[model samples]
Target: MKKIEFYKYHGLGNDFLIIDLMKKRPAVPDYNKLAEKICNRSFGVGADGILVLTKSRRADCCIDLFNSDGSWAEKSGNGLRIVAAYFHSNYARKKKLAFEINDEIADAEIIKSGSKGFSIKVSLGKPDFETKRVPMKSNGKFHINAPIEIEKTKFPVTVLSVGNPHTVLFVDRFDFDWKELGKIIEHSKYFPHRTNVEFVNIVSRSKVVLNDWERGAGATGSSGTGAAAAVVAGVVNGYINRKVEVVFPAGSLYIDWSEKDDNIYLTGPVAFICKGEYLFDAE
Candidate 1:
């Protein structure tokens, strides 16, 4: 077994175990097994997921992200920022990181956030709300005010995709039992690939509070997709203006719902918790 060094970081409160896998495209043949081992809090190194950094001929560097379930995130806002700081503070001495995520090239910057955490802002492309493009069960590109059943509970949901799938539902309050409702909605047949579920409470015309039950990550801190979903739900329901503030377990983020483009932009803070390494083996 090879000793792979790593670091643990958090954006808002979404944490990850990042690794400097070093140059060249690794055959990751068993990345799923690696994710399960390192992300395990009991018998493993412990983390939300693992990030592999490698030299990218397509871009500056490649950040391969995984969920605790060993599933790929496709793109991660927090992961991007963490990498931004990693590249800026450390790799900056030699080169600037112009990385590629989701096949899109984006230049990143590392921001100062006092002692709390390091803030990184990324041009997270655009938020897609179309029902079909967002891959929801709909005839068009948007899934707003759609009816679906979850554990015998009927409700309307809005679909949003920030490189991943999300479903938003407005609730009167944030006092529901997640243990009872989380898994139900996450696995509901209404969402084919399962989904990240959000319960939102609009506090003002521009601000709202929310709770989420993420599919692969389960219930935890903030989710970039969940925040984007809130903006989509707000615009369709006319609860608030297009741009809004969403408060989740991972602090707060500014999300803008562009009426002209129908894309949502999410902005927030990230952090570098710590760094470490471990031995990894699939068999």
Candidate 2:
């Protein structure tokens, strides 16, 4: 048996357990199993996912993100900011930092820091509307504001990729069972690789309310990438402005689809929770 130290953090209510491997590495048989075990709400330290940190050759550090269900994730907006906060507090005090995930690089900036928590802005490159890039199994080029039939019902959705796949649906209200609809869309065969679903209610040109159903994590309080996708879809659909405020059940996040740079920037707060050690078996 071996003991591994981990730090906990939350962006809004979407939490993550960070295991730093930059200083010392541990031998784990399977990271997917480890993520499933550690992210269990009843048996282990509960979190939406886990972020495994290591030294990076291209950027300042690297992250291997795993969903609670033992699925590997390509990118996460909140996870990246949480890592930035983790780096700022422990490793360096610099305002700017870079992280590598699956050979993709993302730049982060610490906007605010205090005793409570940290606010960070992350650039998630640009939003891709190409169906091939979004990885949607479709014959069309783009799936923007198009009716996609699922389970005998057709839904108007705008699909895009902000590092990962997302399907955005603009709704008039949340009076219905959006969760069930989100689940259906997430598991639908239209998206070969399961996609995140965002139910957005546009309040104004610059503000909106978002409910997220992550691909592997189910319904979450907040999602950085989810928020970015909603805003991008809104802008493309002529509903929202370039800069929009995404309000989730837990809190709010700011997203900017920069016209000049053509990058999606997500800004939110990361709160430090607690740190502890977990016992595990080594390979």
Candidate 3:
């Protein structure tokens, strides 16, 4: 049996387990299997996903993330914040840090810190609305407020990519079964690589409430990228401004779609829960 050390953190209620392979490390056979086994809520440490930290040349460090279902993820807003918190707690007290994911660098800065944890601001890159980039199967140029038929029901959705594919739907309220609908939309044929679903309700010009259905993690309490996607969709539709507060079931995440830079910035809080070791049977 091999013991793997892990640190747990959460942005709002969306949690992740981070394994630092920068220093003392273990030779594992499969990271996919490790993620699947360790993220099990019943049998292992419960989390929405896992972040593996390794040494990097392009940035301060590198991160490879996997969902609870053992699927690879391109990027995560909350996950990046969690990693920033972890690094600040142990490594350096510097306010700024850079992280590389799949050769992409995301710059992060610790805006606030206390005994609880830290609030970090990260650049999630630009929001792309092109259908070819979003990879949505469509003949049109963009999928802004386009109706997609599912089970004979047409749903007006705005699809885009913020490091990952997202389908945004603006609704009046959440009185119906959005989860069931989200599950169906996540596996919809229009999205070839699958997609995250966001049901957003506008509160004011600068605020909105969101319920997220992630592609691999289902309905989490909060999603950083989902929040960014909601704001981007709102801006494209002229329903909201460039900056918005995204409220979730647990807490809120602030998003700023900079008109000058054309990049989306996500700001939120991350808290350290605990740290422990997982016993894995290498045999």
lDDT of 2 by residue, 1-283 (tens): 7787999999999999999999999887688988888888998898999999999999989999999998999999999999999999999999999999978999999999999899999999988999998899988999999999988888899999999999999999999998999999999989899999999999999999999999888888799999999999999889989999999988899999999999999999999999999987533
Pairs of residues clashing in candidate 3: none
Q: Write the per-residue lDDT of candidate 1 for residues 217-243, one digit (tens) a residue.
A: 787677666777777778778888877
Q: What 10-residue stretch in candidate 2 is worst by lDDT?
A: 274-283
- Model 3 regions lying over 4 Å from their true place: none
Better of 2 and 3 by lDDT: 3
Over 4 Å off in model 2, which ranges?
Answer: 281-283
Error of 3 at 181 (Å): 0.9
Look at candidate 1 and give me any clashing residue pairs. 5-277, 6-276, 6-277, 7-275, 130-141, 131-141, 131-142
RMSD of each: 2.8, 1.1, 1.0
RMSD of 3: 1.0
TM-score of each: 0.87, 0.98, 0.98
